[model samples]
Target: MNEDFYIDPDIHQSYTLPASVYTQQQYFDVFKKELFLPSWQWLGGKEWSDSLYTQMPHSFLPGCVDEPLLIVRNQNQLSCLSNVCTHRAKILVESPSAKPFISCGYHGRCFSPDGRFRSMPEFEAAQDFPSSKDDLKNYPLSSWNDFYFTALQPKYDLNTILAPIHQHLSSFPYDSLRPEPNLSKTYHVRANWLAYCDNYLEGFHIPYVHPTLNKAITYEDYEVRVFDHCNVQIARCKPGQKPVPLQKGDPDFGQNIYAYYWFVYPNFMINFYHWGISVNWVLPKTTDETEIRFLTYKRNDIPDSDFADTALDLTEIEDEAVVESVQKGLMSLTYHRGRFSPTREQGVHAFHRFIYTEVFADSENIAP
Candidate 1:
């Protein structure tokens, strides 16, 4: 492991992660185990609960983790189970179907939807038949509101990580939201996943990179509140601009809040707006390529933002262009690392610190 990428605890003195962190394939491999494997990842929203969509097959982070998983719904209770069969390691589920039970097509091995071993052919004489090891493995599944999440090995509680956001947005109606499939989309970028995230962690580039968004939000008042496993960027609307309505006793009751951008460490992002929330996952395809999935969940009980979808599309194009440029810049021999702006880039500083601690350090302490 490279100790040179050490991020100082203090923001004022901290240096950015070295270019090698993004350019090297080895570091990317390390990230798979250290950063992503144990972290909670957004799986899908309430839409998956539809009876027709049961037994959905998914591969966690595809090119990265590549763990075959099945989201099974048995009697309306959802569970995430390993899709690989214990017998001969064949993939159990290949496509989404409303199947009542799991069956391995390779050898006729069978199991329950919840991953319990049911029956197997020609194993009558086998010693200690149908042990617990014959059952499919189950991963940890969690939910916030109706959105589901799962992890190969969870390092922190999903609810605990999201608690701050819940408290901050006290009066925001969560149960009244539903997925807007037409508004959801994906973008492929020619840049390291971290590069895109680093750009998102701060509002420093909004004036230059996102001129339209800067005009809507008061950039000078932008604030980032960092927690142990997540960080939120609060963007307040400009004078005379429309702000998301807030109730009394809310955290930002008097402020003209535009949106709350919550970044769960490593990949997932949830941007809360008056109309709804845009959920994003920065999935890694390779050392230098990334796939970003944007899912829009709109509110049913309130008026929606007329321009939210357009704004999302425009901002993504601008961000993609700059991040792709940074990918090319990382390959340059002249630049290695940069410094952080203590006031404006606290979120970025905290992110680098997380990478350093989780990916490089020998200890797990995150505080400075």
Candidate 2:
């Protein structure tokens, strides 16, 4: 496998990322370390903040970047710390429960909720024993409204990636929206995670794959806007539907918008609809399998029936079929790569370019 892959800055001239990126085990392993480990991950909203799950033990990117982590809530503050003990590497928090501090079950090593070294039964006589090394490792955590995100080492700013959503939908009643447990679902797709994202990064397949969705949104008016760390696909609503109420002076003001499909690089999607927000977390389980978590939150003011058709489970099934087929096709020897459609696939082009840059950012002459 080549360590370097080039994606031309000009979409007209550039080719998509090679098939190996989605098919080869070597590339998959490298991506888990170079691409995902340093990228922000979405940790569900509000529930992490509730007093009920103060000491929740989370497996960071399970099956991919499998790292044990603990979400510690101290008063109103939240912290992401290494769940492993400093002494014997035992997992400190096995499950979510209300706990005042962290204690290792293997021994008597204890630490404060904030991950500070507090006590260790057998270390009193040891010199430099209760030093910084004794404390749990802390990870970076960021929030947008009620939602939370964390990273082992974030490569892009979470705020910058989420700016498009905030800028276009500032009037959105964030506080009024609450997670709907019944609406949330996990889909296991038989495809490379990137294949699912590539399918999501464009509206080119809507007409071909999602016939029901095509009728609700004007296909010709679909627009893709690429930002520093993210991209958005803006769909114009059909004649009878109500558009998102953007603040006056905004570029999208007065337009009958259907939804803003925002894709944050690496693997996170936030879709804003008439009734609420739908989040898709594309989690890579293996080179050929991905776990897609569909998390929904509904606004208190909007009736259940007002939710957009795009939010339907049928749409997800349509997407899964297309993506799974793409995954299979990528393994074919005849198809190694393809060119980007400048007008229609800018989001897909941007996504491929990001993968090239992140995977081979250290290489020289990557341009063209």
Name model 2 segments beyond 4 Å from true: 1-4, 308-311, 361-368
User: Taking the tens digit of each residue's C-alpha lDDT, what string does model 1 give over 175-261?
Assistant: 877888899999999999999999988899999999889888988789999987789999998776666668898889988889999
What TM-score would candidate 1 get against the native? 0.95
| Model 2 C-alpha lDDT per residue in residues 1-368, reported as the tens digit of each score | 24337788899998888887788887788888788888889888976786576799887788899899999988878889999999989999898878787988888899999898899887779996778999999999898998999999887788887887788778777888888778889999999999999999999999999888888899998999998778999999998886765667667877788888999988999988778788999999889999999988888887777875444688999999989999989999899889999999999999888877777664532223
Provide the TM-score for each candidate, comma-separated: 0.95, 0.95
Task: Name the lDDT of candidate 1.
Answer: 0.87
lDDT of each: 0.87, 0.86
How many clashes in each candidate?
Answer: 0, 0
lDDT (C-alpha) at residue 276 in model 1 = 75
Pairs of residues clashing in candidate 1: none
